[model samples]
Target: MYLIPGFLKPSTSFVPFSEKTRSMAARTNKDNKDASGKSDGRPGLGQLAEQHLEDMDACIQNSGLAPDTLAQLKLWQEQQEQTLKAWAKRPGREHTSDADRFGESLQDWERAKATFMAQAAEHPKEDSTARDFFSHSSAKRVNTDTVMAKSLKQQYPNLELVITPARTCNLIAYAQAGLASFETIGESSGKNPESLSWDLYVAPARRLDGAQGGIAERPFFEKYLYKWRGLEFIIYLVDGRDGSQNYPSVINYYILTPTKDKAQLLILEVGRWGADMHGEILVFDGGYWQKSGELFNSIMKASWDDVILEPTMKQAVIDDHLTFFTSRETYTRLKVPWKRGIIYHGPPGNGKTISIKATMHMLYNLKPAVPTLYVRSLSSFSGPEYSTQQIFAKAREFAPCYLVFEDLDSLVTDSVRSYFLNEVDGLKNNDGVFMVGSTNHLDRLDPGISKRPSRFDRKYYFPDPNLKERILYCRYWQSKLSDNKDIEFPNELCNAIAATTDDFSFAYIQEAFVAALLSIAQKSKKPGKSDEAGWTEDLGDGWVGILGGGDADGDLEKLVLWAEIKKQIAILREGMEEKQKVQM
Candidate 1:
């Protein structure tokens, strides 16, 4: 006897068929039959007959019969199979593998074919009365509006309707898309290659009213479908939740199409919408326009307090400009253009870029929210005139917005100087638009663009930080490091560091602090390092005096052990000196 693999063997015990078991099975089979002689929602007589044939074949294989008898049985089985196959080949009947019975002869097939041919010959013309379901006629187009109306009538028979301003729609769309839960996907676009990113957020069906414990359900909008421009769109409004907030909503629009070409067209339309509504920055690259995803975290967090600028300069550039914009009616009453321009000119490594970020953050938090349009470059465009027109057109669309032109000298080259100036001061009224431009070299800009009135009217100089400002910057670092309980930074050390870094800019001071902290952290990790003595004799008299008396407890030298600070400060000073030499 052959044995089955242990893993493949069935788990349940098998009982051999006997007279009693056979009788029970017959009774169960009888109970399953209906009065109409059909299957009582179970396996029918055809399945039972097939199972019986399989059982008979198995019994015949196990039994050792005479050769003549076996041969006769095999011949009968082969003839039955051939007859079934031949019957299945006949036209007008669906052929299936499960088909077994056959009664029709070859003459029957010939007679049926002859009859079909005769009928076709008698009426050979196409029928004009019959409608073609697959016809490509324009009249077959489905009306999307009618479908939506009928669906609404059946789903929400008594729904109320409300009319409001178009501006209200913008607010609702913004709230649903901006404030809802979202995921971002980044991509690159244009021949010159610029980054483009968009957000996908769900739209909810139920909208919560301001009243206590009230929810306005929109059951009909759960999976709303509509047609636009001969293509079907299915919109899903789903219920969602934000952090620590309940009952937020998300709306998603999907194109309903089986063809790839139609699906791609729908995606292009959706992408255009995403570019318009969600983008925070507009960049012109490779003769085209692109939108950036969001402001960088570092830039978003920048503020006046973070930068090292004089209080008076901050008040003039940031505070006064914001105040002037709020006085729009005052400007109008005086009959002056409701526009302003400011330019920031300074050497590299100064506070120009950080100040711009701070101003952007300040303006974004205003009462009505002033959006900022950042232009990266205009070098790749066919002509600056067309590019400038497109830029101003978009700026006007988002009026009361801030237009930032970074490295203005590089963008408004000699070729595009006149075109750029015209766009800046042309007949087009740039009301409610505030422009800010920054450049390292003031001499590179054209006189008409930089020195002219009504265009970049105010110019601010960002000089390197003086000694007093340097001391404050050092103290700022000290305050930050005070939070770390393991580190001890004395006030005298900050003052000494400030005095030593006299010619350093704010950027250089920041670098020094970073280097010094890194040195301390590196030294802390090494093993077999015992508490060392304070400043040694090799540090020279100047270093010793700056650090104060050697034995004085809690002094600069005793707190950090001056050698570490001295090493990092020397390295930073050497690097700065080398940079200055290169510039010279």
Candidate 2:
């Protein structure tokens, strides 16, 4: 009677039985008994008669329904009749649109209420507790120890592993939820419970012991991944914008898994992944999340690209440098040698550094990934206990990395050059330790450094860029400048600059762009000032004028020419002077 849209009257209290209603109820009951075939009749008809009597008694006691109640019942009956009529006149038996049944957004809740009543009329959900037979409860916390043990077994299947359990004196003081697994140790007889070792990986949902522990005790997800394949590689998830914390400091740690059969090391990081040691260990970090998802996705796919060195450069150095790597004759000669080292020497800014980087990129293509060392200072190997041994020690830790010592002359002395020679020659048999050294002062290298046939067997000299190379360099920069149309990149201009800049290093060329930017700033003035534009009239003029137009005396012409020609000469002399002053 308390009606909203789609409201239905409660069947129990709707007892306004006229003569026809009473007759219909009797007939319906009789039909139900017949249809069910009550063979084991246990007062089925009697119960129906009793229920009818109770209904009559209740109606009599309530004085055949009060005027207000009769009015409410009448209204509900009329509403039901109208609803049935509307449903019968619909286009289809089922209402396709929710709007038709629910009337609108507000009536949707009423429709849901009506659904349960409609469903109860046909079929109903079981109310028994036993009906939910297949449900399992989830643990509230993760089980760290179990994860570690599982990782161990998966990494090393046959090795004997024992993990000391955390000490908990009050064993049964309290309890929350528990989970564990067992493994048979002695034999697979299936009946020997005593021979089985019960490995516990516990995650206490509620602290029954009232113990406080830090989250640091938990094993990281990396501890679980045992390098599955025979491949040895380290992957770095580099934050392209920042290098600090981009790589893991501790690069190697052994897993309990039996790894004797598989002995390569690997390192994998989220943003960038790289490996150092052959495959014994792996280190991965993930600090590149700040970048856009698209960029991060590209870095993830970067490992899949072929890392072969540019064929042109590879061909040029193959007879000299590449041969030391691929020569069957050399391999056969030092078939059992433990190490191999090569010296890459050339004029500074020529392309020695670029060649080494390209070679590393190539190695990345050939194999998974190798550890790379970018040596910038000779002091990287000079201290009290700062012996070359320390460098070798680190190299040994990352055993199979590409040990690159840039500017080798700084680290090795004529007196101590033998120490390096001995160290490298010692690793001849260990081809895994590939050593590549680069230096511009090749003539200054100790003769003993190159005395060993196997140590410095392959020497490649990188000369200054020729006209052809200069053209290539110019083309590269021009392509990069294509996105900015405001700047003029004339091929003739680049060729002119390249021709005028003799004995110039690639580094100086790169710096020229920076100088150009400085020139723009020096010339351009702030908008508006004393009387007008803040910019100088010469603003936006490239560095060409600054370097070319020297002075009024013609001394400037000679001076400008000298700046380009004597760039490297001045740099080396300046370095020598600084070194002498420091020693003094």
Model 1 CA deviation exceeding 4 Å by range? 1-279, 526-553, 559-565
After best superposition, candidate 2 residue 226: deviation in angstroms? 15
Tens digits of per-residue lDDT for model 1, 1-584? 11111111011222223344333223323212445555445443234333443543543365332222233334434443444344334431222222222213223333533443443343222111011111111144353233333432332233321111221122224324543222211112212111112344435433443333333433212232334355543232212112334423322232223344654554454444544634365666655567554453334556777677788887878766687669899998999999888899987667888788778778877888787787877755357767777888878877888888989999889988887787778898898889999999999999997899899899999887787788777666666555455566677777788888777776666656555555555577554222222211111111110111222226666566355667666887898789889999
RMSD of 1: 20.7
**Best model per TM-score:** 1
Candidate 2 minimal-lDDT segment of 10 residues: 128-137
Name the regions of candidate 2 deviating beyond 4 angstroms. Answer: 1-314, 318-330, 333-339, 368-370, 373-387, 390-401, 521-584
User: Model 1 TM-score?
Assistant: 0.52
Clashing pairs in 1: 202-250, 202-251, 203-238, 203-250, 203-251, 204-238, 204-250
User: Local distance difference test, per candidate?
Assistant: 0.53, 0.41
Full-model lDDT, candidate 2: 0.41
